[model samples]
Target: MYAAVVRSYQESPKFEAIDLPEPSGAHDAVVDVLAAGLHPRVRSQADGSHYASRGELPLVPGIDGVGRLPDGRTVYFAAPDTAFGSMAERTVIDVRLSVPLPEGADPVQIAAAMNPAMSSWVALRRRIAFRPGQSVLVLGATGNSGQMAVRIAKLLGAGRVIGAGRDPERLRALRAIGADETVSLAGDPETAARRVGEAAAEVDVVLDYLWGKPAELAMVPLLKRRSDRSRALTWIQIGSVAGPEAAVPSAALRSANFRLLGSGQGSVTTAGYMAELPALVDAIADGRLSVNAVPVPLADVADVWGTPAGAGQRIVFVPTRGAGA
Candidate 1:
């Protein structure tokens, strides 16, 4: 079958005919992949950078996608960790890991929204003791996941949502989606951070995507215990798009009542993800969630592999050229 093969960690995926993955057990089944997203996790895995990456040679580089089974049931699935994944024309998936989609669900939309939306949905719903009507601040809000976080927070009943990002235009656009307000990470870093700090005083939860300089700057001011320390702040670390290894002030940790947690993978069990995934998929299928899906043929994987998906645009790969339509 035609698949996105990544033989070397340094190079982009090469679309070619490759042997299909064999199901290991009766519980597994083969899926005809309809659409798959070029997620950041897939990129990191292909380049051997993600913590969970196997560095396995001649691997198919996709983490999760939407596919159809023999019974014509459309489903959303994730590849088993450390295995060639969902980027092929057909791949074997553990049926237990696949969530059946609602009838008439858009494959490209689900394929594009699933991974990115799951990041925040699970984080907001399961990771911490999230209460309805809590205030949320989404850092790195320009990205697709971050944008989803803004809406997901509101959907889950956040009292207010503030989006913070480097792009002024994207940040403002977030307001129309779900954010009650937006903060720009543009111009002088310190000034932008101070502005974010001013807004952070009332924020009860922070879904942080960019963890490098922005996190440190956001943390320095946020972690300072104000006159009334009654509001319990939860900082959920979702992704490190900017850079890893943030230099947080020791004083801030010592002085604040904030709880910090890293979500995804090891932090949340597969059972937890599966338990919540159906609801998420249902929401997308019901059109409760909005995603801008840019469907490209899997044949073009080589061309668009490395380019970043712009704000609000998710790159979805359809294995067959006509399926993308």
Candidate 2:
């Protein structure tokens, strides 16, 4: 089997031929790798920027993938904590972690969609109690998860959806997807905050992906406008694309009457994940939710990593020819 292995932290991944081993656990099933999503986290892992403080090395870094099982069943999975080995011809995953793919579903699309969709799903459903007709503000709207968040919020019946991002062109694309309004995240924090507040005078929910000084400043003013004293405004933090640390004013919480929630795959229980999987698939199949993906050969993975094409949409890595659509 040919696998891309990160020999060390902070080093570029190398593609090398390796021997394939059988599954060790009874719960594990070997999957013929069809497509793997190249995400920012994968690059972070390779470059020693993310989860690097933990010091795990010699890792095969990929969190989401779609593949076929020995029984010829197509499946996709959200394998976060476990060792990610999806950048190869074949890999093994726990059966509980795998979800059967719909018939005729594009492997590349499924591979690309699962991670971002799950992130959005988990954030909206588990982290925050998002109710129908509630207004939502999505930060980092051009990002894969951010775009998915906008779509998910609309699908879940958000009364108004506002998208904020630095790119003007991407913001236009965001409106086409689901966002009712788009705001450019330019200028200083105060100026950006004013623009966001003006776009939507009041918002019930905030899906924050960028956590930094700017994000903090922007959120402070927007959150301050929530009027429903009984219903707490939910602010779900899912990503740190801007920076890990944020400078938030403690006083803002007092005025907003908001509940700050942190969400990720880690926050979801196995039972909870199982319960939502069916509805998620139904939404996808019904065309209520859109999944955007870019398919690229595994050989070009390094090049894509070197460039910037791997940033916005889900970049699916097709390990074998004829596997992806």
Candidate 3:
């Protein structure tokens, strides 16, 4: 079988011939990899940069993908924490961790949207007690997952959704997709913070993807502008695209009713993720959640390894051409 093999942490995965995958677990089955997304998480895993990476080499670099079982059933499967990932012609999938897709489902779309959409979906559903009609502010809303966050917040019943990001064009585009308002995090820090504060001062929840200086800078201004500082504010940290560490001010906590927490692998249980997959898949399949997916042949993994997906675009690797169509 041919797979994108990553032999070094410093280099991109190379398309090469590899041994066929075999089922190792009792519930595992070897499935034909149809479509796999080249998500940021996959890049981190390939380079051994993700927190979960054990520095394993000579591995494939896909986290999740759409695959076909032996019985010709299509399913969305999350790759195990092993070297055998979904970026291959075939990979082992544990049936327990896989969700059978409905017939006629678009595999490329599911493969593209699932991982990124799951970030915001699980954060809103499992991470917090989010209520309908609550206001939400998505920091770093220009990126793929962040853009989905804006849409997901609205689908889940956010009365008002404000998207904040550095890209003015993307920020402007966000409003058409459900963002009630948009704020640019460009130019000077003070000016950006003031804009964020003005737009999102009374939001009930903040889906913060940018957690470095941007998050720190926006904190005080947002809190200060709130009509009632004591109002409950839940800040769910989904991604750290800006940076991992933020010098959260002592006053940011002491001054307002602010709650800070993270939502991801360790925070969300395996069962939690599995439970949400069916609904999320259905949403994407039924067009409740829309995504822009560019299908590229898996053989081109090395050539486009570091290229960023276009604005609001997700690149999906098609290992089996037309198999997932």
Which candidate ranks first by lDDT, i.e. highest? 3
> Taking the tens digit of each residue's C-alpha lDDT, what string does model 2 give over 162-271?
99988778888887888999998877767987788677557788788898865787766676554654556777888898889886788767766767877765577877
Candidate 1's C-alpha runs over 4 A off are: 225-227, 321-325
Clash number for candidate 1 = 0
Q: For residues 28-147, could you state the per-residue lDDT of candidate 1 as single tens digits? A: 889999999988888888899998877679889899998888898888998777467899899888888999988888999999999899999999888987889888999999888999
Q: What is the C-alpha lDDT of each candidate?
A: 0.86, 0.75, 0.91
Give the winner by TM-score: 2 or 3: 3
Clash count for each candidate, listed in order shown: 0, 0, 0
Q: How many residue pairs of model 2 clash at the backbone? A: 0
Candidate 1: C-alpha lDDT: 0.86
TM-score to true structure, per model: 0.96, 0.91, 0.97
Candidate 1, residue 234: how far the Cα is off, in Å:
1.1
Between candidates 1 and 3, the lDDT winner: 3
Residues 1-325, candidate 3, lDDT per residue (tens digit)? 7889999999989988888666778998999898999999999999888999978779898999999999999999999888889999889988899999987899999999998899999999999999999999999999989999999999999999999999988989998889999999999977998889888999999999989988988999999999999999999988898899988889989999999999999999999999999999999998889789999998888899889888888999998543323
Indicate whether candidate 1 or candidate 2 has the larger lDDT. Answer: 1
Residue 290 displacement (Å), model 1: 1.7
Ranking by TM-score: 3, 1, 2
